[model samples]
Every structure is written in structure tokens, then in C-alpha cells.
Target chain A: MPGKALVITSGKGGVGKTTTTANLGLGLALRGHKVALVDADTGLRNLDVVMGLENRIVYDLVDVIEGNCRLAQALIRDKRTRNLVLLPTAQSKEKDAVKPEQMKELVKQLKDEFDYILIDSPAGIEHGFRNAVAGADEAIIVTTPEVAAVRDADRIIGLLEASGLYDPSLIINRVRPDMVRRGDMMDIDDIIEILAIPLLGVVPDDEGIIISTNRGEPVVLNGRCRSGEAFNNIVRRLEGEEVPFLDMRGDGLLEKLKRLVGLR
Target chain B: MWEFLSRLFGRENEASKVAAKERLRLVLVHDRTTVSPCLLETLKEELLDVISKYMEIDQAGFEVNIEQGDDSMALVANIPIKEMKRALSRTKN
Candidate 1:
């Protein structure tokens, strides 16, 4: 069977949209699944950088779209995993350089060959975002457990529903369990209550993500990272497996403190 | 007493909740329904105008608020009897 086309999107920027894409792609690929991650941000691409495949990109998505190169030529195989490929976007061209129809066709071509086609959508509900979701089998809405992020996620949920795409799952990123315990930040339940989407993964705030990204290594490469485990859980959920949410902090005390400080 | 104690005990929590509810309601009202605050105000004024000509409206106690969450904006107008009495007294007199 062909793979699932998953669009990882968050309407708000700086809410870990790209991180979710990078880690989830690696997580699924690590599970022996053939995964292809398409950076749909177009000109403002960073999936290549996050995936550590920037040096390998001789041809990009635009190259394949414009017939400058074959799709295979554009696809850069992961130095770490053969099953994973990074379909990078051209940094020179703007988001509208490639149309949604073109993206649809491209994802369709890769569908049969891959187990998961994860597209990283640009922040904001614009042409870039639309093109990213044009061929999504399902959408994994990434958001932090903040009111602003959750509000934006709710808007994206509305847009997805308006577009006739319902049942999009939620990926709560940077959830500080301590803050959640203290009620300084919105907890998983609060987020779930607000977004009302099925939970795919609950990623805790981890400083290691920055270190890994700085090294051109995805957090998923490190099994010990909380974010990595969360990504793995999401991948398993995508495979229709039931994996429990991973609370980075062992106790809910922090969640309570966050609530006390009005950070939740 | 318990309510007061709970309220006092969870003062920070209550404040955050109140703040979250207020902000979310304000932001999401426009975000979900695409209705601007000016338009909503205009609508409220128009609604009050049309209704005031009839039985009674408590203009001071009247509130046109938008409920946020789930489907976003849910317009709720609350006009108090005291407001209607006050309006009726001011206008009729």
C-alpha cells in the first residue's frame, strides 16, 4: 500500500513546527518505515539543515517541479538511514514559486514508494501552508501548550475543518511538565480540552533540541531525549499503535507551580 | 466559606483562568468568526437600537459579549431589567 501523507503544521511560528517534522521523520524512519520528508516552506527551507542533509542537496523540490532534475535526483538520501530521504526546498525561490497542484503531483509520485510523506508547512495560513497540506493524507498539528499557540492551533484546526479535513491529530511541543504541574502553563488536558483533537504526541521542552539542531542532528537520533521519545510515540500512533504520552517530568508538581505563576 | 477558601487558595490559578478566558474570548472571537470588534460593536448598537424601540432595554446593564471556545464566537447579549428600567426612566421622563 502507498504511504500516508502527513503535514506537520502550526499556524504560529517558533512553536516547533520544523522540529516536529525533523524528529517525526527520523522516528518513523527508525521504525523500519520508508519515510520521505518534504520541506514545503519552499524558499525558507530548514528541514535540510535540521536533518543534516544540507550538504547533500544538489537538486531541490523546485528543481524537480521545474523539470531541472528528476525527483530521484532531487531526493537526498539520509546519511544515517537509507529508508529516510529529505526532499529539500529551494532557498532562492519564494513560496509561490511552486503551486499547490505541483506539490500534489509530487507527493503523489512519492506516495507509492514511501511509508510516510511528512511535509513541514510554513507558519501562517498562506499559500505555502496550503501547498504543504494540498496532498496530506492527515495533518499533525504541532503546537506548544500556551494560549497563543493553542489559539493559533485552534484556528488551524478551524481552517483544516473548513477545508473538509477533519480529525487532524495534535502534537503538543515544549510542554514543561513542571509548569503544567504548577498550572503556569497549559497542561496536556488543558490543550486537549481547548483544541479538542486526538493527541499524537506530547513533547516536553528539552534544551538538547537546540544542541542537536545546532549540530545538524535531529533530536530523534538521541533516544534519551524526551522530545525524541515523544516523536517516537507519535510515529507509533501514526502506525495505528497505542503508545502512552511521555511526561518529561516524573511528577505533576511543576504543572501545579506553572498554574500558580499564571504561566499555564 | 469553602468557596472563599478555595478562591483564596487558588487565587493565582483563578487569576490565570480569568485572564486566559478573557484573552481567549477576545482574540478567538475575531479569529474564528472573522468579525471585527468594530463590526461587533456596530452590530451591538444596531441590535440595541432596534430592541430599545420595543419593550425595554437596560442599556447600562446591557452587555453584548462573545463566547469563545469550540466553534469560536458565540454572540450573547445580556440586557438587565435594571438597565431597561434606567433607560425607560431616562428616556420616558
Candidate 2:
């Protein structure tokens, strides 16, 4: 049976689209699903670096599309998870290197082999964004609690609906529960009200995410940190399992005192 | 003491969050509709011209805005007409 293809996109940059793709792909793979993470952000590819598979890339998505390499040849297996693979993007090529129809064909080819194909879209609503979502069955939009990110997410959701990918789920990344509790930052409810999409998961602002990214290990692999557990829950939700959202509020009296002092 | 301080700070934050939500609500309505400020101005001007031909409209009282709903947006126009010139023409004939 063909697999489900989902595109991870954010119209704004640096809202954790690539990170979400890397972690979600690994999370699904760990749950015994064959997953492939495609770096659709050509010329600005960083999914390879995030996945720690930067050194193993001999052929990229463009290469496969241009007929320079077979589709199977471009897929690099993860160092830890054999079920997970990455179809990297070309660092030297432009976004136009792959057309929408070509992307559709590539995704169709991969659908037969992998249980889930997750595409990491480039920022902006241009050719790159178009290519990223060309073949997606569904979409998962990542955004922060900031107004700018949520605004861009709204535009992306509109674009997705216009393109016939309606009802795209949302992942509110980098949520500061402490700030939300104090009404300083936008809470999950605020974001959902604006985006008007079903919630997938909410990842807390965790230092462990930065460390995990630097180490080329997705936080899901450790599954100890708050962000890691969030990713795990997202995976379960994606698999049609009903998992309650994690309580991201700060714990203990000391934390409350620090929040009171405006220390975060 | 901590509760008191937090409540004091919390009031300011609550006001800001309300402001933020209001701002975002208005902005997202425009964004989803792809209605730029310039576009809205043009639309209002064109609507005024078209409506003025049919009646003597109160230009100062005229308003055109996008109103967002739960699942849709509407281009609402509140054109306050001062008098119906077309009615006068019909009566004169």
C-alpha cells in the first residue's frame, strides 16, 4: 500500500519546520514505521545537518529528479534507525531545480516504499513552498507563539486550503509555558484561535532541543526532555492514536517565584 | 509577597495579550483575504464612485471593511446614502 505523504511547512523562517520534520520522521520510524524525510529546501538544505547525515550525501533530491541518480541511491539511511531515511536537497542548486510535477512524481515513487514521507519545506510562499506541498496528502504547519509566526502561518493555511490541502494541522513550537501562564506569551488557545487548525502537538521551549540539534540527534531519540516527549506525542497522534497533550506549565514553588520576579 | 507582585505584573501582561489577540485577529482577516491596505483603499474608492452615480451618498459616513467569521471572511460595505437621486429623476419624468 502507498504511504501517507505530509509536508511540514511554515511561511516564516526559523519557526522549527526542519526540526519538526527531522524529529517527527525519527519519531515515526522509532514506532516501527518506515519513514523518509525529504529536504525540499534546496540550495539551503540543512535537514542533512540536523539529521547528522550531511557527510553521507552523494546524491540529492535534485539529482534524483534530474536523472543523475536513482531515487533509491539518494536515500541515506539514518545512523541509528534503519527504518528512517533522508532524501537530501542539493546545496548548490536553486529552488527551481525541481518542478512541482517532478516533486509529485518523486513522492509517488517513495509512497510505495515508505510508511510515511515527510517533506521539509522552505520558507516563503514561492516556488520552494509550492514544490514542497505539491504531492502532500496533508500538511503540518509549524509556528511559534509570536505574532509574526502566527500571521505567516495563517497565510500558509490559506494557501494550503487554496491548493486543496484543507484542514492542515498545526504544531505550536517553542511555547514558553511560564510566559503563557503569566499571559506574557500567546498560549495554545490563542494560536489555535488565530490559525483555526486542529492541534497536533505543542512543544515547550526546551534547552534540550538546541543541544539535540547541535549533536545531530533528534530530541525524540532520547525522549527524556519536554520537547522530545512532545514529538513522541505528535507521532502517536499522527498514527491515529489518541494521546493527550502534555502539560507544559512550570513545576514547583521556586519556578513560580522566578516567574513572579520576571526571570523566566 | 510573590503572589502580590505576580498579580501586579500579570495585569499588564493580560492587557498586552488582549491587545495582541485583537491585533492578530484583525491582521489575519486581511492576510487570509489577501486584501492589502492599498487594495482596500482602491476598492472603497471604486465602490464610492459606482454608488454615487445611483444616489447622493454621504462620503464621510461611507465605510468598507473586511469582517471575518468562524470559517469565512466578508467584504462589508456600509454606504450611507444622503438622498436617492434616481428617485428624484423618476418622479420628475
Candidate 3:
């Protein structure tokens, strides 16, 4: 397959776009393909910290875009993985510092050398969001199970559809099976009923993500998180493998059968 | 059952189905009809206005909202239907 660029975005904040980017980068890289993750959230950057390369970012996205540094000079090689790289955004620059064209050219430069160029977009329909998805061949819209999150995800989907980027897919994150069962929280069925994008993966709520993120290590490096496995499955699916979506909700087989039969 | 299963055996199609359904339900209700929650509030006021011409009514005891779908919002206004003259007589002294 040809090299692909994917921008992971959400219209609302705190829906784990950074975490998804880091994990997808790790998951794709671990499969032995060269992957570069770019932070398009220019001013408020965190992809470096999530990928654990915060202290090492001497040159950043702004530097590369503004000719302050060469493309290779701004690339921060991940410490643990040879296949993974991070193009950290310059923390001090405004969202308008880098034009959408500049970001597209940078990704074009990286696309030939990398298997997947994942852009971590800021939360909103503003300049940062536009610049992030400008060069992409695909996108993964991360959203939670909340109504507000789902509503914002719809807006992002609408924006993507309007942009003519049909490569956009959905990843419903932080789903609580208990709340879903009690009908208190929205289920994957409920979310899909609303957003209407092609589903990529479903990541269950896991505490390991917080600890790993704080330490500048993504949960992908940890083995216990099923969410990490789910991300890996997404990567495999991206690689053209047919993998069944494992029901992590531990849904009763009988319950599913009953739903299939249209019985309450 | 077999026909339906055969139709949706693949991964890509089903995911799109779920996404499409959700977007349709929320946006149509929110943006399409102009019958949003705010409009429902105004409708409540209008209903009160129409009824107050004939009788004395309790404003706080009523509630109005869109239900089921954006097009078919239910207006269930609970009124005591107090007699205007009888209620006014108690204050006439």
C-alpha cells in the first residue's frame, strides 16, 4: 500500500486525540513500519510528552515551517523505537504561525519515507484543525460516549465531509460498560447511531492511560490495557487484515442474540 | 435472518451505518426544524398567553418540551383552570 497520512481530531477537548495519536503511532511502528507523528496543535503541544520526547525537542514544527530548521533537523527520533519519530509542535507559536500549505508540504516530505504520518489536531474547527487535516489522506475522529462529545464529533464529521475527506473514521473512547448497561451512559450503539462514520475501533476506559501519559509513556507500551490492544487491532485493520471487533463490554452472548432477535 | 446477515457480513459497511444513523438523529433535531429547546420555551409562553385570555393560570406548574422527534414536540401544559372571577373576588376586598 502507498504511504498514508492520517490526522486524528475531535471537535471537543479532553476526548483523547493526543493519546490516540501516540498509541496509533506506536502500534503502527511496532508492526515494523516507519511512522511519524506530528503535533499540529502548534501553541499547546503535548505529543512529545505523550511519546516521552518532551525534553529533547530542540527544533519543532514552527522551526521546520519557518525555515528556522530543516525537516530532518526538527525530527525527534523516539528513544525506544527505531521505526517511530515525533515532529513536536513549537509550544510558543500561535495557531496561525504555520499555514495549511506549509503543513501539507511537510507531510508530503515525510510521506515517502514514513508508512503513516499521524497528525494530532487541536480541539476546534479553527486554524489548527484545518492545518492538521490539510495534508492528510485519512483521519480518525476520536470521541467519547457523552452527548456533548458525540455532538462535537458530528460537527467534525460534517466538517470532514464538507472538506471531501471521505477517509475519516470513528473511534469511540473511554466507554464505561457499567454505565452503558444501566442505560445511564451512551453505548457504542448509541454513539454510532448519532455520528454515522465508519468505525475504526472502540477503546474502553482504562486507568493505565493516565499514569502512562503523565510519565510521557503511552499505554501502547503497557501490556494490560485492552485499549492498547484495540489500537493495535486498528493498526492491523489499517494494514488490510480482517479482524473481528472483540466485544470488550463482556456482553452476554445471549444478550446479543436477543438484541439480534429484536427482543428487549 | 440469513438475508440480513449476508447483507452486513463485512466491516466497512456496518461502521458507516452506525455513524450515519447517529448524525441524522441529532442534527435534524437540533438544526433542521428550528424547534430547539429554546423554541419550546417560547411555545410554552405562547400556550400560556392563549389560555390566560380565558382564565387565570399558574405559570410555574406548566412544562413544555420537544419529545420523540424535532417535528413532533409534545406540549403537555398542566393547568388548574382557575376561574378568573372567583379567584379575583378573593382579592376584591
Best by lDDT: 2
TM-score of every prediction relative to native: 0.77, 0.82, 0.72
For model 3, residues A110-140, the per-residue Cα lDDT tens digits are: 9988989999999999999899889998889
User: What fraction of the correct interface contacts does each predicted structure contain?
Assistant: 0.18, 0.64, 0.03
Q: What is the TM-score of chain B alone in each candidate?
A: 0.47, 0.58, 0.44
Ranking by TM-score: 2, 1, 3
| Each candidate's interface RMSD | 2.5, 1.1, 8.4
Which residue runs does candidate 2 get wrong by more than 4 Å? A254-264, B1-9, B35-93
DockQ score of each predicted structure, in the order shown: 0.19, 0.52, 0.04
For candidate 3 chain A, the 10 contiguous residues with the lowest summed lDDT are: A177-186
Q: On residues A1-264, what C-alpha lDDT tens digit does candidate 2 reach at each position?
A: 899999999999999999999999999999999999999999999999999999999999999999998999999999988999999999999899899999999999999999999999999999999999999999999999888899999889888988899999999999988887777788888888767799999999889999999999999987657899899999999999999997766556986687578675
Candidate 2 C-alpha error for residue B38, in Å: 14
True contacts reproduced, candidate 3: 0.03
Interface RMSD of 2: 1.1
Model 3 segments beyond 4 Å from truth?
A: A251-264, B1-28, B32-93
Return the DockQ of model 1.
0.19
